[model samples]
Target: MKRPNGEKNISSTITLYADDGREFKQTFTIPLKANTPPPKPGYAVAKTTGTPAYYVLCITVPDMDKTAGEGFA
Candidate 1:
């Protein structure tokens, strides 16, 4: 599947299909925050002065795929 991209925060679930036909469900969200400044010639990494964004992932195992309130695995 294509990766999602945007300036807004995202929170949703997605399904993944394995090569062996093992279908699995997973939920993931990417938070959109301020853009960090680009690194200069001497900088090894770009520094972020603002709040950092985050990613949340919740995967459902094969055995418990049908359980209710099964958030993160």
Candidate 2:
């Protein structure tokens, strides 16, 4: 999530099921850096490489029309 017209990489996919029907899949790659300054009770970003990596959920809407709330306060 980089502004100034650039940067934004985020890919994700998680599915797991078991109960007579088995299924498992996991993949994630999150790298959004715009100097990392967008956190107001919300923040996330992680991408380490396989073997053991986590923290994929993210939310960084710097302006997005005031985080989609419209009348931002």
lDDT per residue for candidate 1 within 1-73, as digits (tens), equals 5533433334455667889998877655555453443233321334455578444444434444345575742
Worst 10 residues of 2 by lDDT: 1-10
TM for every model, in the order presented, reads: 0.21, 0.21
> Candidate 1 at 9: error in angstroms?
2.0
lDDT winner: 2
lDDT of 2 by residue, 1-73 (tens): 4355334334445566778677756544554545443445567787767878766767765454554345753
